[model samples]
Target: MNVLKDVATGVGLVLATPVHMLGRLVSNVWWPLKGVKDEIVLITGGGSGIGKGMALKFADLGATVVIWDVNKKGADAVVAEIREKHGQDRAHAYAIDITDREKVYALAKQVKREVGAVTILVNNAGIVTGKPFLEADDSKMVKTMEVNTIAHFWTTKAFLPDMLEKNHGHIVTVASSAGKVGVASLADYCASKFGAVGFDESIRFELRKMGKTGVHTTCVCPFFIDTGMFEGAKTKVPWLLPILKPELVVDRTIRAIRMNQATVAIPRFLYFGQFLQGILPPSISDAIVDLFGANDSMDDFIGRTKKD
Candidate 1:
């Protein structure tokens, strides 16, 4: 009976593999998008840049949007803009340091009581210290990790229980291309983003193992975006790795969430780069990177003046 079961499993895999691949291909062009009208979405760093862009877009789509940022004025402005279009009940804002676990937990309970359970969480807040490893301050490095990586733990802890109970939620990690590959003068940023990418992947597996298939995860790895957060960054190959626009990144991220894409590397070319990176020898890969000047992309880096 065990032998028969193994044979059946092999046959099922053979039949399903090709169909699954085809479905994935078709999904890029056309997939039934999940609705957000009934969702309560919590966005970290929603005062500006990608977070603010997503907050506005989600509210326009009819989801109740919650903005969290340390900058009270910025967060309030975003909330007001959203409320103007969707009505006051459609948007809310909170000013709190995400790295403070106690504050995050307290706010989570308050949010649950005031606004419904957060059905989607965007861990989009991040910071960068654009300095060579030795020149960078220890405090800045620690802060970078706290904001870009550690905060995910607190935020997820705050909201994931409700998701697990309901068996429905989406967690979006706004990682970066720097997360996938190393760049000079951004060692701290790279390390934090790498942690974020790994966190998203691991949680995805855990959710599947726990039979919480309704809870989805999307890891977004986009090249340098022109949001003032990365003000003076540059790219060598304009056609291949042009600095992306915030609007384009936000739109793609929203689409990925609605379609439940597991991971999306912007411009699609990055996909090929990642594939090549894995198959090629390290020396050869490094040579390719040198040829493309990937490491030099941040040479002129003058990152956001005021940290989010």
Candidate 2:
């Protein structure tokens, strides 16, 4: 009976796959986007880079925006810009270290009191130590894990309860292509991102199982962006794998949030590459990676000096 059930499930999936794909394609292209005008969006690392860009975009869309960063000045500048274009009450800035779980919880409560229950949470702040594993500083590695992976837990916990109560919210995880595939010279960074990607997926499944289908989760996995955070990073074949731009990533991310996309791989080619990497033998996969010169792309690393 169990074997029959397995065969039945397989047959059902085979029949459903094409229809699912076509429905997804059509919905992505033609579905009316969900509105965010009534939302209160909180974005970590909103001081600069993609975080700043997303803040401005969300404010432009008429959502109240909150910016959190260790760099208070940068967060304030972004808030000021949003106010100038939108309205005085359209944006707010808060400076806090997301790595501190207790502080994060405290600030979250303050945000709720000052602004409102956060309806959209964007976990975007991350740091990278572009050094070989043996050469990487122990402190920097711990910092990287705290910011990239562990902070997600703190931030999500701080905001997710409200989402569960209402069953109407969005969580955007700004991970990296490094989260999906390993690259040379980024051992610490890659491990942190892998954790982040896993975190997002697990939470998504948990939410669905709890029947909170309206609470959407999007895990954004983009290749290195031109955001100075990954300065000097390069690809041997630009046509096949060009470095992404912050603007492009921001736009796609917003769209994905509206459409409630589960996982968004920028350039779309990443999906194919990941599929191949999964099915191919280790030796062949390593050879392909070596041929593309991906592992050596960080040989001349000059990442941003300041955190976002």
Candidate 3:
């Protein structure tokens, strides 16, 4: 009887899948956010890498983009490039330390006044320190937490009230694949990203409970990209766990935001990683991780500074 019941449930889900997809398609067609002229989108850490890529894409799509970063020169350079490609008025750059709550709030208000209503918020700022657990200092750990995890709270709190009132907005949190699986030598980085993932989930739940389904939330977790941050990180299975390009990640991320996807794991194999951990024996899993040199590969880590 149990077997038959399970089969019936599976069949029901299969039959309902098309209807669910069709509903989403129709809803999106009626209320498309992509290429919506004059829509304001704000991206943190928009100075370089994935953030800069997304900003360029959005501006090309006719959105007014605000590039917020602590690196004023980098931010201005990106804005200059955007202005050359898309009209001068389409992109703006601001220097901001997202970790400061009051500063973030002030920036949000300034953006609203100077640009327009912010329809999209992308929290893409992060820093990674590759020290071993024993060598990790409190100051380094605190900075990581401030930038990667707590900044999300500050940004969300500052912008969400406006979203709730307007009833239209999207929030994208750029976390790391490290958040899903704990590896050696990156304890602090992993912990900070894990907190970001959790924070995204909790906010999603709160939105659902409040009946604000239109306020879309997406959490992105990707493996080592060819970004400056992971300059020396080696991939055990290049084909399976290939280091992604920043442009590719940015493209997919923008598409996800436009479509209002709730979460995304790049490389696709990451879902299998999650499944494996749930079923694999502890010793077996540990052996696999060790074989990949997943932890100690960062022993000679040289990040963005080295790239310079």
Question: How do all models score by TM-score?
Answer: 0.94, 0.97, 0.88
Model 3 poorest ten-residue lDDT run:
27-36
Candidate 3 C-alpha lDDT tens digits along 167-228: 88888999988989997888999999999999999999999999997788999999999878
Worst 10 residues of 2 by lDDT: 299-308
Predicted structure 2, TM vs. truth: 0.97
Q: C-alpha displacement of 80 in model 3, angstroms?
A: 0.8
Q: How much is the lDDT of residue 181 in candidate 2?
A: 92
What is the per-residue lDDT of model 1 for residues 157-218, given as tens digits with 9 covering 90 to 100? 99999999999999999999989999889999999999999999999999989999999999
Q: Each candidate: how many clashes?
A: 0, 0, 0
Task: Report the Cα lDDT for candidate 2.
Answer: 0.94
Clashing pairs for model 3 are none
lDDT of 1: 0.93
Q: Between candidates 2 and 3, which one is better according to TM-score?
A: 2
- Candidate with top lDDT is 2
Q: How well does candidate 3 score on lDDT at residue 86?
A: 90
